[model samples]
Target chain A: MERKYWEEEIETMPRRQLEKLQVERLRKTVEIAMGSKFYAPIFRERGITPESINSVEDIKRFPFTTKNDLRSTYPFGIASVPLQKVIRLHSSSGTTGNPTVILHTRRDIDEWADAMARSMYATGLRDTDIIQNTSGYGMFTGGLGIQYAAERLGAMTVPAAAGNSLRQFKFIQDFGTTALHCIPSYATRLAAVFKEQGVDPRDTTVRIMIIGAEPHSEAQRQRIEELWGCKAYNNFGMSEMCGPGVAIECQEQNGMHIWEDNYIVEILDPVTLEPVPEGELGELVLTTLNREAMPLFRYRTRDLTRILPGECPCGRTHRRLQRFQGRSDDMMIVKGVNIFPIQIEKILMQFPELASDFLITLETVGDNDEMTVQVELAKATDDFQLLDNLRREIARRLKDEILLTPKVQLVGKGVIPQSDGKAVRVKDLRQNH
Target chain B: MKTIKQLSIFLENRQGSLKRILSALSDQNIEIQAASVADTNDYGILRLITSNQTKAAALLSDIGVLVNVNEVLAISIEDNVAAFSATISSLTDNGVVINYLYTFSKDGRLVLIVRPADMEKAELVASAQGFQLIQGWE
Candidate 1:
């Protein structure tokens, strides 16, 4: 068989041997965590030591870290190493509020690049491929993360950093781009532009699509794959976990094989804070075992996903993660029923007539809370009967997905607004409306 | 039988969108001889038989409106009863399916713009019925 992994020894090592390495790394990581001022209190209170982590399971003793903690600490509060030693820093764009920052030393950068490279290899990218990167560069980790990995893999890199759809299409056609990396939302928007220009995405030179940085439903992913006529891999990561190299789908495309050797993955009950058994869904908690300058212990990523039960055919021993469902924080409870914006997005994708541009608004009038889904029709179809039929069908389908019938509002093309980076899917007016 | 070309501009159903398009056209000094809004709850298709086809299309497209030029038969008839119904009856008799029909009083006559299922059959029916099909709108 042809070589499959970037690091065969590490990627295909025996589970027992991998566990030994993980234990050793866990001990060192605890020491590294103790270096941080934020973790020092928890260490003293919990009586954590380098030897405190006797086995991998002992990591359960560590307390969880949160984005709010990172926010509270702000700049350099989580940094274990001195200020001068840190060479690079990446900050979350703070979709909710203020940005949470992460620092990386020279060694930390190499480790990050290695994780990204291994993931790129797992997704079947090669040095011979031409890569077009559309993620925003600077401050955000999406752009630089993939660019460095592609470059390290020796692929011809086109740093087409987001937006300017016309120019992006020009570059893709002109350069014969073989691989693309961007958020699923941006990729979906580009498909519309391709249709407008009479360009067939499937017939194009792009063979692989790397989608990450935002939560998307499986239906949305399938729509993008169908449009481009290429296989798309789901990438799972956050700014706290070195920005999108944490887990990625291998060629099997069943589940993402998270790099278990570098991090300890746990699915825990969000309320009880206890680990759920294999194949069950829960909040993803990650502990960075190999990162320097900053090390996280059980950082609550807020993303919801489950662990796949069986071993993958790809021969990688790392545990695989299911496609991220949605952010727990983004879920909206409507009239005693819980609904996710991605669930609404999946239902919207079922209708080809509706453009991908959409917004879900949650408002309360009187005593009841209503979720209003506003979307745009792909074409300016003025047939009143046809449009009325479409509206009714959308409401019916959405009601089927979420038990509560939504107030469906249809807009014209481009009326719901377009998302270039991470899509803003919800607007909550429960307090005011 | 001479058929004038019609321009269809896609407009969102929101308020002020049609006004914005009209202001853009008005700023360019374009004259509309006949116009109608084929609307739905979500969007509207504003059909126009302007004084100029190429100029109107270019003007709307420049203002970022999706504009498509189509061939539609415009009948210049007297403003009397059955003037519009007679033309509709002629097309129906000859198996010419009219997709949609809109009328506006222009040039001291009732101007009916007919979107037909088939152009050739509609023209044949109009010619056989002695209907005066204007080549282009005033």
Candidate 2:
């Protein structure tokens, strides 16, 4: 018989007991954070000692950490423990600026795996399952982070790190693979490959899919579920707080249950920097309570989501978070209209005639700014009227949402460049002029 | 029922897009018997009468180019203005409208490739007028 919970004791802990654990861990995290070169002076200036955190609410008094702090400190300044004690490090891509690094002790790596294991178990993956991880390994934590968790869950893991869709199918058939972990965009592209190769995904051994590392709409998730014939679960995690395991959706498939035993979750207005009303949309702020090598104190995640109100049918005391809307930094301003890429994605995915890939281009036309949305058609058609109608419908739907008409172009499949890495959805050409 | 198989390809209005499609077909040794490009500022459609369209469509699609196969009327006529006008008037006088038409000349023989708004009407009119309609390209 399958088990009800991964760690029933911790997962189903009472609310009062959970809050007590959070307070105790919060104090410990504050002390650990003070040991770092990055937080020592800041803690002194803010008069924040371990005793300053009486309860989880006291976390509001502590100074909020930003990405700029991580960048300014560079590679090792954020480590709470000595460099000699650290066993591993993961750094994100620094396309915009200096790469922010997260250091981990041997114990920290173990705990990260344990957390990820719990998340996988919540999605009904068991030791009997063969998990194939398709995320790239190395510095990208999704690769190693998920790999360790699958191993910790006692599942047979195939570390088929990223790309080479042909080999992925071979492993799925030959190994009798039962689960897959990959980003959402790559998941859709994989579906296309499955079609091109004439493989019926529903007939395969796969039953569960864990998709993350990019913001996707509910429509997109439903589309993936229909294509892969599996229960697609949304995973919410950032490298700052161990990747791929901080939160996960259970079989209920309602909202992602954030692991409260390991971290304190806070939702705050991005501009006001104050906590929003319960169940209101805001930026997610996190503080690590279990990490040893680097215990980030009130680190701002910049991701926009809301803590779902009320209890989940699954009965986990930990709070559930709605799927991330978009990053605060990812919002684009076009002619005084604020728009998130996910908003466009939500509308596009609703249409079955369209493919998963799209590119939003902002350009300067004469003295005016114009937006053009280039999306791919799922298949080629000789009917020009059908293509024209699709373009107009997409434009009309976008105008209804954004209040500005964008020039919508329906292009051929594979016209927009798709890479093994994250999909680049927006291109601002107005910067050139 | 007598119609020519034409491959209509979607091409983005950017540098090297047409070249990429042409090079892919060229590498496969696919002969392009006739070609016409309908262009706009953002994108264009390249229509072609190929020696082996089914093979050409499969090859181009495999290379990530969008190709659609459709049947368009191909009428053989004299390489003169009068012959061209007569063939077009035969369809228009029978209440059929031509959406688009492109011509190709080979060895003093002119062929008008017509994509009529109403294909059934155009096919009946061409057959009734005894116009030499090319069925499948050699």
Which predicted model would earn the best DockQ? 2
Which parts of model 1 have CA positions greater than 4 angstroms off? A95-97, A330-433, B1-138
Q: What are the candidates' individual DockQ scores?
A: 0.14, 0.36
- Give the distance in Å from residue A296's predicted Cα in candidate 1 to where it truly belongs: 0.8
Instruction: State each candidate's chain A TM-score.
Output: 0.78, 0.79
Residue range A293-396, candidate 2, lDDT tens digits: 98887889989889999999897888999988668777788898888776788789989988888999999888788998999877766666777888889999
- Restricted to chain B, the TM-score per model reads 0.92, 0.96
Residue pairs with colliding backbones in model 1 are none
- Score every model by TM-score: 0.61, 0.62
Name the best candidate (by lDDT).
2
* Clash pairs for candidate 2: none
Model 1, position A62, has a per-residue lDDT of 87
Residue-level lDDT of model 1, residues A351-408, one tens digit each, is 9887776888888888889778888666544345666788889999999978888878
